[model samples]
Target: MPIFVVERRFADQLEASAERLDGINRINADEGVRWLFSFLSADKRKTYCLYEAPSPEAIRRAAQRADLPADVVTEVSGRLMPDGSPVPIR
Candidate 1:
């Protein structure tokens, strides 16, 4: 699987109820995309989400189905360690 960092921007404060979240997860699963987690900006108008999927296109499709923004989809190889070294994310 490939890991991706998705940047989404909203016109207003971002909000999603638990039921809406469950629906989004179901939609993601249908597209073979796993929602790892997300970080919210201080204003809560933006989110940086991590995901695992077969390809960037799969992620895009999932986003489209969920009617969510996938403003930037970047593939990441691994994590950066404090010892000035790179480590595999898995």
Candidate 2:
């Protein structure tokens, strides 16, 4: 599996898009998405998403359903240690 991170700028339709993502996650079990984490900037005008999916395309489809900007989505690779810290050796 691969990880995709979406760096998002606020949009008028953000709330609606988030709602759609919830539904997508509920039904797309075969995609092997391990988890999805979303964070809102302190100013509330920006956001980011971390996703674990079987491949880049899986994340892409999920992002499209959520109305994420195509240019902002990117793939990343790494892992976390048992103590919840990212492995920095990469």
**For every candidate structure, what is the RMSD over all alpha carbons to the true structure, in angstroms?**
0.8, 4.6
Residue pairs with colliding backbones in model 1 are none
Local accuracy of candidate 1 as per-residue lDDT tens digits, 4-88: 9999999999889999999999999999999999999999999999999999999999999999999999999999988979999
Task: Please identify model 2 stretches exceeding 4 Å from their true place.
Answer: 13-21, 27-34, 79-90
Clashing pairs in 2: none
* Residue-pair clashes per candidate: 0, 0
Structural similarity to truth (TM-score) of each candidate: 0.96, 0.58
- Candidate 1 residue 65 Cα shift, in angstroms, is 0.9
Candidate 2 lDDT for residue 17: 60
